[model samples]
Target: MIDPIVMIVTMLIVGQIAVSVPILFAKANKSALNLPLAIFLVAIGALALNPIIASMAPNWYALYTALAFPALFMLCPSLWFYVEGLTADTKWQLQKKQAWHFILVAPALIISVMILMLPKETHTAIFIDDTEVSGWFVSLILVSMLIMMLLWLSQCVYTLIKIVRRLSHYRKRLKDLFSNNENKELKWINWLLFIAVCTWIISLITVFSSSLLDQFLFNGTTEALFSLILIWSLIHFGMQQQPALVTDEISPKVKNELIETLDNNKNEQSKASKTALPTKKYQRSALSKEQSKRIADKINTVMQSEHLYLDASLSLHKLAQHLDISPNYISQTLNQTLTTNFFDFVNQWRIEAAKPKILANEATILDIALDVGFNARSSFYKAFKQVTGQTPSDFRKAHQT
Candidate 1:
């Protein structure tokens, strides 16, 4: 029988690796936060730590200096990848320099190990650990890990902050481009990064704090952190693999873009609009271009006139009645020409409209969301994110910048 604790930890590591494979193989949105690469590196690095430790064999204590030394460098790759993915609106790219972030730090990492291997007589003792390991050496390793961890955490925090700053800009752009006000806080963008930060902080607290420990504290902290890693794996790793899409909330413009893109004669994929492939099937419609446009124009008028999007219950059926068109026609026109369904198309405008209101800072996100026609803050939030890509709090942060 497998030891539950060890097996669980092993599975957590495996899940992290498995989660990103689909994203790497499937058609993923180019502008996405590169979950595949980040998770891949993190999974490998996390798993590699133990093996590297095992390699320290025979030398035993000497292995900490050798194997544990390079672990710091290993850790940096996943973090940098995640941050770059989060911050960039376009698909992420690693600059040549970025490609070498780990490499550049390697020399220091090796030096730290060598310092750890130095005779205790060579340096003053700081704290006593088992064996004759000098305080200076252990302190150096601990300090290095602490510094790197802080650096990683800081970058992750700053990237999300930058994304939040773009919220106001999204509002201004959407208002002029599409006159709707439903999305307030771009939910996806904020929530994912927010969760990432929270999870990372928890990991940091667990992992780094373990460095200060001796045998007793190390055992408890490692187990606790491993437990957290297990829990986090169940959640975040699962999410990364599936890449939950707010398809219903996606705007017609984006959907239209996708449809047009898929049908286009271009042999090579254009980087024009970052998009993932659509595996979901859609039916072909009999509606003509002229008929679809006419229908859309009428709906647009009603949308602006009654501000229908603010009504959270609004749907193609409800709006079709107002347009004096059949629901089939409404859906057909929306699918064929607009490239998105009625729900998302209208809600996109609503979210766009909600941006400015969120910016006013007078209304809370929940209040502004309702004022704009959302039934619940979560729905408003989901739509807002599906369309614009920021959260209400971040949206507020963007305009202030």
Candidate 2:
């Protein structure tokens, strides 16, 4: 009989997939991540189904063993694909070249089939009763399975590490591109990948040790439980995540400016190093005092005339796009010349804009707050107090005739 705990966990896995798959498809956004997620669910579900398969048809255990390896092989590939989709600037689609990623799955399937296609006694001995076969064929099969498992484990680890590195790079990229990236940071995925690594490690331990396998089916049960959590967390959190692609977020003219900035960055890439320089104070190396003053003046002019601060979503990168300036240069100009950061600089304008609204007393405080590009009432109050030395109500009452 299949272990009840394993059975329960497997059922939970099935239930999670049943609910999540439909929701994922129904959602209009982040559909790029759906295919990889679907593939991952299918792979996990197939593995979880093994206990049921073993119970119902003991005689057909050979066939289950044959297919399970290939299913297992799909897990890492699916994960890598999901990360690729999640991090892409535009909607991700499978290209003809990416077909090679699944090349191992076919071979794994064929090997399983070939083993099952062996003589009846050989197949039975290999799949059902290993003690009955002490031949070279059985030894060869054992070695091959061991080798395959090791390779699969290696690939899973490699892909997971790549995901970590990619996520790190993405975080740095976001920092460079946006003044406020609280919403765009993908830290949840890091936790997900960590859990996956733990799951994979537990699976490997359970597979190699016969004593552990005999005591309790923790391997399958743990995997099923973790898979359930992973899927649920993904569905709940993943749906809320918005893409942070520069091309999608900015206009065509802004995109052209960004492209030029990128081209200039490429030119500077060779001379730059990742090493951190000693932190003292802002220094103007290539940017002269006159150039810095010009940039700072231009920034004030643009912010006042164009009312760029009215965009609640504006960032250093977005502002750079507007002025056809590189974000690095913009940051330098703001710090060295203007002696202000992006947050204070933008909020200063927002505070100035709020003054007229407060004086007029035409709209409610909340409405005025939102209209002046403050997303939250609390944020507006905080910035207003910081800038004006008085609350909105106090400021309005004091100015009233």
Candidate 3:
């Protein structure tokens, strides 16, 4: 009979899997993180079902077990892919170069095939008595399992290191590109990576410390719990986040082109600034005071007249396009001329737009927050306090009476 705990876990896994797969593929689920996450849930669900299958069908258990090992190796790579999807500026897709990451699985696959090749009587005999297994075969299996665990541990460590480096670089670049880094920071992806690292650590420990049967059951139960937590958090945090329109670190060719353009602009600016005073108050950048004022004026005029901040999906690339300027140039102008960033610069206008509505008592605070492009009332409240030194409610209260 299947273990009672295993059976209960299996039911939970099945129900969640059934609900999750459809939602993952639904039309509303557009994030690149969705596919890898769906695959992760399916892999965990298959693992969860293993105990039930073994109890119900003894003859096919070896095959089931063999097929499942590859998915175990896939978890970290899926997570890495999800992070890449969030961080990469260009479209994220699995490429041929990344195939090398899976080379660590070849030994496990070969060993699994070897297990599958065993005669039915041999499989049954090995299941019943340890002494029936050949020493060489047992050694091969042990060595392969050891190698697989090492690969898992190494992959987890490598991924965590990459995530740290990538997030650091990403955030630094966001500071350059966006005034408000709150939405573009991709903090949820970091949480996912940290949780995955913990799960791998647990698996690594269970592998060495437990007997074969104990390892299977203990690892399965523990990993199932982890999987449930991961899936729940992944969906909850992930589904709400829209991928950034542009991330840091685009192609070298494009970066070089942007550098060339900026350099050209600077040469022209120097000639123009030759007669102008060197110490205008807002003229901190190498760009001429004239050009900085021109761009800043254009930015404000467009923002005031077009109300682009109301779009909620507005981004640096989109704003640059609206002004017919390069994104780098827009960022530089904002940083140097206004001493602000894109996120703050835009949301400042949003907060400005929201104030009149709040003072007029024309609508609910939540409705006004949503109308002014904030996705959440809490986010609006935070930005409002940051800008006005008062919450929306407090500001409204003081102004109304």
The most accurate candidate by lDDT is 2
TM, every model: 0.42, 0.69, 0.67
- Candidate 2: regions farther than 4 A off: 22-31, 119-125, 128-132, 208-220, 259-293, 300-312, 316-401
RMSD list, candidates in order? 13.5, 7.4, 7.6
Ranking by lDDT: 2, 3, 1
Please say which candidate is ahead in lDDT: 1 or 3.
3
lDDT of 2: 0.71
State each model's CA lDDT, in order.
0.52, 0.71, 0.69
The TM-score measured for candidate 2 stands at: 0.69
100-181, model 2: which lDDT tens digit per residue?
Answer: 7777787687678778767777776666555557777667777878788778878877888888877776664554344345
Top TM-score model: 2
lDDT (C-alpha) at residue 154 in model 1: 64
Report the candidate with higher TM-score, 2 versus 3.
Answer: 2
State residue 328's C-alpha deviation in candidate 1, in Å.
31
Local error of candidate 1 at residue 299 (angstroms): 11
- Candidate 3: tens digits of C-alpha lDDT, residues 278-330: 42323444566578779999999999999988986676666876787766667
